[model samples]
Target: MISFFKKFEEEGILGINRRIGEYILPYNPREYYPLVDDKWKTAELARQFHVPMPYHYGLVNTFGGIRNTRELIKGRPGFVVKPANGGMGNGILVITGESEYDNGSIIFHKADEKKITEKELYHHVSGILSGLYSLDGNSDSCILQERLECHTFFREISFRGIPDIRVIVFLGYPVMAMLRLPTKESGGRANLHQGALGVGIDLRTGTLTHSVCNDKIIHLHPDTKRKLSGRVIPCWEIILQMASRCFDMSGLGYLGVDIVLDELRGPLLLEMNARPGLGIQIANRMGLLDRLRLVERIHDPADGPKDRVHRMLQEL
Candidate 1:
């Protein structure tokens, strides 16, 4: 065990214990955790900061609100139902489309084209409200969100779901970034733990550099067979600005800003994670300790979001 830790430090990889004690614990205050943990709260903060995010169709907190699920999604072509405090993509239901019949019976289509009835959808929301997927064992509210269309760039690379870019911001300076692509095994969710692909991005050029799945390196996508390198991310500068601004909005020195590209809207803030994972190092084939140490040495508290992003791009 001693030698194993020695190897981790030799590689400069940020282990869980050190990550918490050095970065998360010191940079992230416990009081501001709710700003990032609860998706609804994050959305409210984004509104105050003028940061773009997915539209909130409505909120379903009570079991009684579950009855009006159809009303929540009335005029929309598709909608997403998810626990506001859920993590790792658990208890997320995406309804792609719906068809109404003369008898008033309607059928909903999932991302997989699987049909779901209204009763079944209500049951799923009920389960979310029961704290089944919440981070804590407490009742949670469900967020009814507008289903965004994937940008053309990601649609060609992703299997059947949207891809999101995760930028790790330290003291309002951008440090590392990775693009998470969904696969069939992940049920069309851009979550790395559930068999999705984590592709590292070049912070300087917004280009793809490396990729990994389950900590194993791969050059081509498992299903698409597309070469997973050299593709440049669109709206890269705007995305970085949004990520840096989130630091001010949330008041957390260290956090992960998840952003997605919409067909209409260029990039929308998906959510923020105060305790971001370390798998990003494996995907980038580089340790985070050096980059983080560099940021700590030169990060300026007086600089604004745009200035911070510029410095990181030039120096990191």
Candidate 2:
């Protein structure tokens, strides 16, 4: 037991308690959490900073709005329905396509290939409005967002759902990043706990180095059977700069920025997390202690977003 603990200490593995005490509590402010907690509010803030995000068709705040879900979508072949305050990819519904019946009622197809009627879709929206999947379990609003097509790079490696990049930024500097690839087991959602794959990415270069699933290291994707390493992320610099800019936008010293590559839109910000999980360390086979300390010691508040990204990546 002693040796096990000593090894972890030598490796600088950050445990949960240390993460919250040393990073979250000291760097993140309570007042600024709301900006990232509510997806709808984050969209409004993204517009102010000119940060690109998924297009929102509309929001359903009340149970009555659930009845208008179809009208709000306005015949979009593909769209996403999620709670404004949801977390961990819960309360998210993906409508991949739809066909109308002869009677004019629409039948929707989910990403999983299950068919859903208009009534079932409305019920899901109503559940979101009731906060069934919300972070705080309070009444929540439902967001109707544009479903982005998978980028070609990810489509080659991922199983079914959209793959997204998770960037950990501290003091406006990007310290580490991971590519979250959706898997069939995860129901096509890029969530690690749901069996999605987390691939470590080099901060300086966009090349993938290592991958982990269910806390175990692996090279080939479980479902796709493709080699996970050596794949370089396209538009790497732009993604880093955009993630750094989010810290400036949210005013959170420690932050997690989720970005997705859209086939048409390039990189789009999904949302920000003030209390990002520590699973990134496992994916990268590294600890956040050294990087966090470096940021605390050398970060220049006067530097612009681009400068912060360049300087930090070089330093790391």
Candidate 3:
């Protein structure tokens, strides 16, 4: 079934739809830009808007920052070291704590069950510093951010790493949202194609509808076997408000806002993706062509945030 879907995604109706969907959705790859592409700019904007992001110690654009990584992480708990210009869920390290291995080698605990020796972690960081994770071959910056604890609500569904809420916000209104689940296949990551499940959500009710994994419909989790429906997300209203405010913050007509529900921190903004994935279409089993058209017809960027939100709720 997986192979069949891969083939269909490559050459069947699904493939064609993906191609057409890009043009139909205003926030498709070509239409949106990445906030992280410019590390300094991203930091400035995030700071200006009071968005809660991982605490950034320093950015390594030159050799100086890379050389002082030990100094940056000194006394800090386990933190995430990632490339500022990376994408596709690559070059990210989630450090849980510090420990020593049986072999007396110093290592970092990514989580309870995952550990990476200091040598290995340094090598990975070096690769990111050398631009292995950047879109182009250009040199990149590595940022050390505070690690966030996964919220309890997602404990049953998420394998590890952080489970983020990807919200499709159009014209300052949220149109669709899905909780990206983590799995072993995704290496504790939440990318949909990497074995995580995309659970569709009803925008108005904040209720789960259906879930899709690797293009196959799933009524229950493959690992936990828990029913996927009736999962009510905590802080649903706050998440919606944050997403709506982001449209004003970014000034972008359309965007995808990623919010991580931290165990203690409530809802925190992860990052904003201007060019959100079309895989959401398959996940939700609802084509975006009609919705995009609707947004285009009713959307007015000049609308106030409260008014826009009120209008959106009315539509729901």
Candidate 4:
């Protein structure tokens, strides 16, 4: 056990303290955090920058707004309710579908097959307004966004949820990427700690390379039992392009760009993170310190997204 741990240290596994102290603290400015921390603000910024994201119906910022949610989302076939200030995939409610009865009461179907009523939905939104799931336990805004249909490729590997790609971007260049796949254990949420699989992808080629679940290495998806490597991500270049552009949009030097592939829209920017986790190194079975240091050395002002991607590939 000691040798195994030593190997991890020798490989330079990035810890949270080092990540925050070295990369995040140095690159991310304090003033711009609200743009990414608050989902409502993030959506507004995306609109101004023409970055594609899930369509939001409206925001419920107060407890009173919760009472009006049913009318707001009434016509939608499916939707997601999330706290604008939430983190770690908490306080997110995905309503897959709904049914109305003769009494005018509606029943909503969750991804996990549990049923909820309109009143219950309102209550959940109220909880969000009270900051039950926010990062700092402060009053939060609740947003209802259009539910995304998973791309065909991920639908086969994921179980009852949409998976998203996480690309770690440094100084306008995408350095590392990973695909987060939801499993039954995550209750249909694509969160790593909730038991979703993290599959590493080649930065240039978007080819699957390695995977992990519950912090343990794995090669096959738990539910699909399919090999987790070699599959190419659809719209790979577009995904990286979106990630690269986020640097200018948010002004964060080092960031994580979360993107999802919509069946019709292709790749959409789900969100951006000022302090992205260091799990990509674990999933890729590599060290981020080296890649980060290497990226720091090669800074060319003339490089575009395509140029940066090509430069990395050429060096590889």
**RMSD of every prediction:** 1.0, 1.0, 4.6, 1.7
Candidate 2: count of backbone clashes, pairs at least 3 residues apart or interchain = 0
Model 4 superposed RMSD (Cα): 1.7
Number of backbone-clashing residue pairs for each candidate, in the order shown = 0, 0, 0, 0
The lDDT of each candidate is 0.91, 0.92, 0.74, 0.89
Q: Candidate 4 — worst ten consecutive residues by lDDT sum?
A: 307-316
Return the candidate ranking by lDDT, descending: 2, 1, 4, 3
Per-residue error for 83 in candidate 3, Å, reads 1.1
Clashing residue pairs in candidate 1 (N, C-alpha, C atoms within 3 angstroms): none
TM-scores of all candidate predictions against the true structure: 0.98, 0.98, 0.85, 0.95
Give the TM-score comparing model 4 with the true structure, all chains together. Answer: 0.95
lDDT string for model 1 (38-92, tens) is 9999999999999999999999999888887778799898999999999988998
> What lDDT tens digits, residue by residue, belong to model 2 across residues 23-71?
8898889999999999999999999999999999999999877878778
Compared to the true structure, candidate 1 yields what TM-score?
Answer: 0.98
- Candidate 1 lDDT score relative to the true structure: 0.91
lDDT of 1 at 17: 92
